[model samples]
Target chain A: MKFAVIVFPGSNCDIDMYHAIKDELGEEVEYVWHTETDLSQFDGVLIPGGFSYGDYLRCGAMANQSNIMAEVKKAAAAGKPVLGVCNGFQILTEAGLLPGALLRNRDLKFMCRTVQLKVENNNTLFTNHYEEGQVINIPIAHGEGNYYCDEETLAKLQANNQIVFTYSGDNPNGSLEDIAGIVNEQGNVLGMMPHPERAVDELVGGADGLELFKSIVKQWRENHVNN
Target chain B: MKKVKIYVTLRESILDPQGSAVKGSLTQIGYEEVQDLRIGKYLELTIGDTDRDIDTIVKEMCEKVLTNVVIEDYRFEIEEAN
Candidate 1:
């Protein structure tokens, strides 16, 4: 399946995401500029991590106002698998595609390190390849990765089984409930702060992140090709 | 002409780590009476005369891009431009 890595100005991790998909996953990938409006051609959407719009005003605020975000929303509405990592996760929350807001880290510091993540729900299309309650190592780098939502929204997420991943050991950013990642109610859109794309190679660290991309492709193939 | 001053702050329910850190520094400097502090954004906009209502325009701007209503609360005041 073809994947489109949305690129906004100041996005540093775009290349990493592209390499992960093209070189590691062996999938067709393209860098779609933030100005582009049409996203109908891509099967999956990946919003890479970076300081989009220089994190002005707030992280992901200005980037969410970009023209491509409307098309990203359209892609999500069409049930396309949308994976947002780091600043991409912030953009998704800012755009209201995913619930909650990523606030400044509780320690008020930019954290950069690999952390353990537990698969909270493996039934969704994004985490199906991960064993239930398995821990995987993924790198996270961000200043505003603290996720927050109201108790009511948290209840809804819990009820829908949308909390996909949680910090396994220590919460790096002090996200509410140690939430590392989450999917939307439909289970098609996922927003996570960890850099999974950065973990796709055993040479760099581990290949745990490949399962996420593979799961998306496998699910897409099952729904499209097998049907 | 108008001078619009907008203040954006994290909602009280949300934790403000920056604010907390600042408070910690204050305490370290011997300001024991400081009860609490919340860090926020302040923006001043100078707008030329326009046909649209300035209040409506400022409000719209705050809702659209100036502030994120999900986790932030924004308030603005308009003053005569000098």
Candidate 2:
């Protein structure tokens, strides 16, 4: 399986994502620029975390208009797997690849710490390895990490089982229903505020995040083998 | 020459930690009447043409970058300035 990490001007976590995939997963990973339009060679795309476009206008706001997002949207529409983390999540929401939106942290400050999140729905391709209600620890760092949506849309997300992750214990960012992450209707695209890539290695303090990547690669390999 | 105002706010289900923090500070300062506080974003855009559909543009901007619809809701209005 191959991984492609999109790099925007202010993206600081692309290398972290790249290393997590290449060094740990031992998978071939490529850093794709936000201006690159071609994605025919990659199997999956990872939009890493960071203050893209300096979080101007809003978090992930300006970065969503980057030239490469058009192709990213195309790939997402085609059912390609895409994982967006932190600022990437904001970008995905802005790009309409995912439902809902991220808002300012209710504290009006940049929250940086490990947060416990529950695997609200594990049936999706993104959370197949986690059991429903299982708690996972990941770091969330952002000033505008709150998530918002209308009641009708929220009901639809619940009905479709599109929500993938929810905060456990006390809600951290004031996200609706403590939503830490979510997938699109097709379940191929995922956007979350927590930094799973940062917790993939044990030396970094925890290895809980490694399972997500493993699950994806494992599913991809299994699907290919079965076909 | 039209004007539009957009109001964006976090849904009720979501907690307003910042608002709560402010409320706490207010209470510490002895302003206890403040029951609850909610924070929202407001945008006022000026459209040069009076008949143009500023609502659509405002909504698009909200979707594209103005607001994150996942956790927030936005409503807008267009009016002629007196």
Best by lDDT: 1
> What's the distance in Å from true for residue A111, model 1?
1.0
Each model's TM-score for chain A is: 0.98, 0.97
DockQ each candidate and list the results.
0.85, 0.49
The top-ranked prediction according to DockQ is 1
Worst 10 residues of 1 chain A by lDDT: A218-227
**Per-residue alpha-carbon lDDT of model 2 for A16-109, expressed as tens digits?**
8999899989999999998888887888899999988888767877888888888888888877789999999988988888877787776677
lDDT of 2 at A106: 67
Over A23-121, each residue of candidate 1 has an lDDT whose tens digit, in order, gives: 998989999999999999999999999999999988999999999999999999999999999999999999999998998888888999999999999
> Could you give me the TM-score of model 1 versus the true structure?
0.97
DockQ of candidate 2 compared with the true complex: 0.49
| CA error at residue A145 for candidate 1, angstroms | 0.4
